[model samples]
Target: MSVLSVFVPVLAASPAAVLVQATEPPAATPVQAPSTKTDKATDETPVIVVTARKSSVTNKIDRRVYDVAARPDAAFSSANDVLARIPSVTVDPRGRIALRGNSQVKVLVDGVEARPGVLNNLQASDIDHIEVMTNPSAQFSSDGSGGIINLVLKKKRKDGLNGIWSVRGDDDGRYSANANVSYKTGRWTANASVGVNRELTVTRTDGRQHWQTTSGLETTTGAGRSTTSPRSSYESASIAYDLSPKDRLQLSGNHYRPRALSKDAGTVLITDLSGVLDDHAESTVNPDRGEGGEITAHYTHTGAIKDEHFDLDITYGSSQSQESSTHRLSHTVPSQADQAYTYLNNGRDSSLTIKGDYERPFGTSRLTAGFQAEQNGSDARSRSENIAAIVPGEADIDTAFSYSRQNLAGYVTWQTPLGRWVVMPGLRIEADTWDAGAVKRNDLRFLPSLNMNRDLSDTTKLVASYSHRTQRPDVFQLNPRRIYWSRLYAYEGNPNLVSQDTDSYEIGYEFADKGFSSNGSLYYRVNKNPQTDTRRVTADQVVIQTVVNADQSRAAGLELTAKGKLMKKLDYSLNLNLFDSEVAGMVGGETLRRQNVTYSGNAIIDYKPRPKDWIQLTLSGEGRGVALQGYKTGYYRLDMTYRHKLTAKWTASVRAFDLLNTSKQTDIFVTPEGDSRTVSRKERPAIMIGIARSFGNTGQ
Candidate 1:
């Protein structure tokens, strides 16, 4: 009994211990054979015990899986909230995701690439598990260079009806509601879910920039504050049917609608070498509205041969958005310089993908092959006008831009086991065509990967992998239109921007001991033609920010995560990532270099004094980081949550977010000619209370 108590905590720490791994469903039979039993058994009763997986964390050869669907103290309301708990992953104040200190991560829903903002609309309750693939295999797409995060949705697997309803509210005028229902009967299953939310946020930005020109130096200082109110709703439905004992078909659709309004006011001061200041006061109001929808279908067939399979997947998605901003400025130095401007922009995007794969067993080895064809297109139109002209070159401007891309890819992989090790090797071939206005590009690329896993003992394992991937230039990065945000700020896309290619390598170790589980990895990445955001100052001291292809860069990092029970009533988990990065680039015939060493980590501790009550505290933060031409400062946050069960079907919870309200960012840019510094801060401290209920079949 003493040994069992110590061992139990180790096996249960990983989220994989909570959710059963996916497996093929048992073949249905019209009738069952009678069971054989002794006559004496009929006079006695039978006893049975059932066990279910609990919320924990675990790792595979290529990824780490986190299962939080059943954790009452997880405090996971949205997809973003779930991501915060993952190791080496961070969600910024603006909801942007960064993995391993890089922002090029890709997010997918059930192995499919979803549209932007899709994750924000999903309820965490609907997610079965999250897989963080630091080094993906050939079966995955090669679109992103950083990494991949996959969200797996829950499905109805039982032969009954089940549903959940939850509502939440906070002191900052934010409220949300979600409902999910599913039913399974015979060989068919159906599910539907809906979520609605309204949120209000306040933010502030204050910064100063100093430019060193040939003559001397020029400085620009500004500070601004804004309030945003956004409302969004989402709906999804899915149906699955078993065509036969070895075949199945599934279909699903999702729709999301969101609208937001923002108002901001600020003051800017520009000073020359003589210390003479030109002061300006500015205010703006912006309104944005958008809607997106996606439809997907999947078909699977299992051959008579064991471990043989074929599958087909198809998807179509579309979105449309419109945004407009009105700005007013007042100048103190030159009263006649005061002016007002209005800008409007509208955009539409659509994409289609068709993929199919086949897998078969060959003796003691397995081989899989797949092909994918995809097309994406986008169009945007912008109009900028001077409401009250107080300067030259302020005439009305109207422009339109459009871009399209077609991609075809094929990949093959073979996996075989030898002794106590497994080896996999894969290759992918891709052909791409891109078109924007009168510009066109065509490229053929080959990507290769190798992965190996070895078991050292019953309680330890090792894995090593390498892969080559690419990040294609975005449509907006290829557009050549000049978009003016204000009189002193404007940007123009570069038609010469090219795709960034990356080669990544990782070595990992997994270990387990009494009441504890841990995993660690060391990774290195080399990038070519790295795309970067560059800022150029004009003669009038106007900063133009644009995307450009840099020379080269490289990054090396180490990541570690661990979870276990400290006591019978206390559980704890920790995740950490440390990395060193360097970038080299040439601008205007001058060589530039920037290097940095940064780190980030997250820790959580939970205590349960009673069977029905629990409390948890989470600490997460980041360290200083370097960019292409500059560096950024980081901040930390503390959060807490408490939960109590009111009844068998009802649960109550409370949460405090950003308890210290110290989440902020500061950045510094360096150049041979001059340097700039910018600081942005936001205080987000709020408390919330929520309730959840589950009815129908209680067993999962």
Candidate 2:
């Protein structure tokens, strides 16, 4: 990327001549400043005037980039907070993220795959920008059928030592601290960072179930309260050496440890047509611990020609986790013997990836090619034990399994200008093999993609694209062992599940001028063998949740976004999405079809009361979500933040989340055998305050 600087004279506003530079053009245009000069003859200064123009959103050929620093509240926010304000993206109060109504989205940091819980620990100040790729090219991975979101971390290139440190705490017993430092000398650069966080959450849940018994209608009601606390710590280091003016070698490594504990107290009542059949009080305790680490090496060589380079990257990662749960039930209504249940589970995973890419300019066009290979393995073991005084014939479970997968892929793409349009077409070929206990499978696929862009005017453009994507089942989804949540509830995976494939098409229009910009798009997608969850009840009244492949599915949507300055001191952004989806599949030996229309949107407003102080407010919500068996209710939330620059090196911020206390969620499930409903709510709103300090010419 290249930085452009422009100078223009305008009427004087503050009697100061300022030079403005565009970092990421063409979305961010230079702000012409006033240039004043006194006439030697009359000693009178001429007046010049100008206006400032900036935008946080940037539209690209295959993706959209959101500048994190452009947001007013980014100084003290988390990665999840930034994602909620992005167009076509949704984040729930529980920190679950979804893109375009799809939850199975891939997330990356600094062009590398991110580990679980990494995003939660990353602060907005550490990120330079975020990229959303709805329809990526053949050079990217095809793991996520929904799309991809990548976070680019900030890099310091100053010739001296630079560092930043910050600490934050919430009213709900949650706290975090982070520190980062970078040093550059001669041809060598080194960077190091450390972070630690403790999160506390409290929730309440209520559920009701209705079913038909041999005698008559039966009903079950339950209510529970739970509290969870998770503590995590991480450390990372990286070093890069310039072998020559055109060659570079870099190595990096990271390690993290996460631990959590949860406790729940609830009561259940079972009743038939006659009256209450059974009632019990239950208490459960769960503890979990995990550790993960990764190391990567990268080498890059720049050719003599412009836009020509060859790169190689190799990475290895490993993780291990263990969890245990204990539950005790005491009879209430009909005074019976008490029961105790204990469950233990352990899991381990390791993966290695190697990738290489080459790019060169071809006349007025460009050519790019890449190859990738990956190997992954996982192991899981679980045991369940039950001890009852009166309940007999209860069975215990012990199971262990191992799974492995290997994948190799190659892709090539060519970009050329045709008349008024720039067209890029690409192809990708992949071979995959998987082995899990008695299940073994092999797959070969060929994927194609095309993208075209035409300039209608200096400030307007049109774009069209098409791509084929695939998503394979993860290890958790492919395991065949059963895990019991309660005496009457269990979960199992499907080893026979196959990969899901999707064909996506999109057309869009973009317009930018002055200080405003707008982007609108229409997209359609068709899916084959989409994966979904299904529930079935056995003769023993146990509910089993498992995964299955749907016969067919389709989705169509329209997305609109606009960002501009409402006034000299105010800027705003608005986003809206409307879509309809339909799916048909077989569940519990019955064919079922589901369809619905949904809408989601978010709005952000920033106000600058003073040159060194600013405040921001955000509101986001979504409509009811459609599911294979039922639907999930919609909800909206309000967030506010205030920031003040104490000095050039110090900053202070305060933030509040869920101001309206409307983060509750409800899920309904209806089937031929029974109907169920569940509602969950957070205990209280969250408020946080933080302060940051920077040194050694670090840009804020």
Candidate 3:
């Protein structure tokens, strides 16, 4: 646990010659008061930081950190609220987070890859600090080709006891609550947390386009709305105890319960069609519920060597979901005779990973090596039932399958600094063997990286790096089973999909000062057998999407970012990234041409006109550059907040989104078939306000 920051609650940036990362040689911050409760304990925090590429003890880091402590009744809803506003980062609309605009990134929690094979679901309040490592060393995981983001959590203490609780309700009629606490005594510390959440989210898209069918006949477009909702509930609990200063054990589990409920109904009519109304209506109720859990334990020891350490960890996890569905006519409730159809599915999997690493520091250079032995297995069983409407007969089928994969890996990395130039180089090798009943497969990959950084001055710097990485297909992506998101859209996994390998080269420069900071980077990422499906497709029956691999593909982009204090009461931040992607074998033959996307970077300003009054205005927007030229659309949203301390312990707050009532465009999906057509769409605009108060003297 370490920190390097001094906050004054920004109205405008301050002209302070403070470093985002402090070097160890400098004087450290003064110690603060100790904890007065159990479960929470006091620990050492590194106040001095070493910045640079490989970062010498005298160099400074180029990233900034934000403090996001939890409050009562607070809920973290999305990645958008957590990663944004931090220095050197942005997460695009598709849950794609990146430094600049690279999706090949690594996300970690507490320094460990957070269930490497799962999705990102960390809450904001659960986060202590978001470490945005724009340029990492060889000691880091070399997977996709983007920077690393590590979300650190709060530590437990040994003493009395104190914890926080929160609850929230979303627009889709979802509610959730969470609580965490810890306790400690003399030589022991223990902590526990549990949470439950249920929410419904709906997405709709509308677009107009022109298309040519397989016969080469062209037609103009129509627009409509298709809605999709993921109504689900999740619950989890975890506990951990420290055996010693260097050893700890922890266990955790979670379950996801979702109402497999969705319906699609829309009308698509040509702008000039005479009595031509192409309409499609369908509803699917997937018996929605899922179960998942994990158990893991680890031990670590710091050696007598000045900077040597060793860690050993083992983990086991599994999850499954079952769905039952019967297609129904939209707006129709069968009376006399209705046949019921049930579809059942289940996903069961487990993993055991034994990983170890050793690190040592010498002079201005550091060296580290690690190894991992992992085994993953899954067992699945399923059944289907279909009954006729009238004199019905039950039709049933049962099936079973099993799969396993074993992986062995070893890596070595070196980091060093000479004068103001920093350098890091490392290599990793992995061997994997897969077994599925009568079939067996084996794959091997080697990853390498070389990075260099130079401090042009105390306020300016230049950086360049090159890497060769590999991405093995995810297990879910390789499954052949059909994944039903809704009746209109279905996903079929391809077990025979090939792995995608990539080599990335990047160069960038930055300028940092008390009043202003600007940074820009250019990168090119080339891939072999990239995994991306047709962005959009059309059909008369159902939108069927087959998960397939593409030939070689190329993605290149440039990002420009600027931020600083505009005045004593105003701050500004802006970031823009333009990227191009080319795919072969798409739409048959010729390389698919598409415009690059310019992702959004937001800016916010807070004004404390008086000691009891404050106001915050934020501006946010995103524009996707597509191949269809004018297919990109964007919006400017304004959110304002006013807060006042009515009394010493009482406060009130109000915030609004789209305050001006300006219409905003969210997304668009269009496809055309010569004989007939289908369309999917969605949009939104809203405003919100809330108030609260406190009776205790919480830390200010």
Which is the better candidate, 2 or 3, if ranked by TM-score? 2
Worst 10 residues of 2 by lDDT: 42-51
Error of 2 at 211 (Å): 1.2
lDDT of each prediction vs. the true structure?
0.81, 0.83, 0.55
lDDT of 2 at 229: 95
Worst 10 residues of 3 by lDDT: 52-61
Order of the predicted models by lDDT, top scorer first: 2, 1, 3
Lowest-sum lDDT 10-residue window in model 1: 1-10
Which whole-number lDDT from 0 to 100 does residue 512 have in model 1?
70
Please name the candidate that would achieve the greatest lDDT relative to the true structure. 2
Q: Tell me, by TM-score, which candidate is best.
A: 2
Give the TM-score ranking, best first: 2, 1, 3
Task: List TM-scores for all candidates, in order.
Answer: 0.91, 0.93, 0.75
lDDT tens digits, residue span 380-487, model 3: 665655523211242354666678988888888777896778877878788888765445778887777777789889888888877776666666666655443333
Inter-residue clash pairs, candidate 2: 10-48, 10-49, 11-48, 11-49, 12-48
* Residue-level lDDT for 416 in candidate 2: 90
Tens digit of lDDT per residue, candidate 2, span 1-700?
2234444544434476664533234455566454345565323433332333344677777789887854545546778888898887889867778888777688887666677856666777678889998887887778878888999876546678987788889867888888888899998989887888888888898999887767777888989998999999998888999999899899988888999999988888989978998798888899999999889898989999997999898999999999999989898878877788888999999989999999999898999899999999999998888733323455666889899999999999898999999988999899999998789999898999898899999899999999998989988999987777766677899999999999999999999876888999899988899998877776555677888999988889999989889999999989888999898998878889999999888998989979889888999988888778888998899998888889998988888888888999998877777988889998888888888888895756
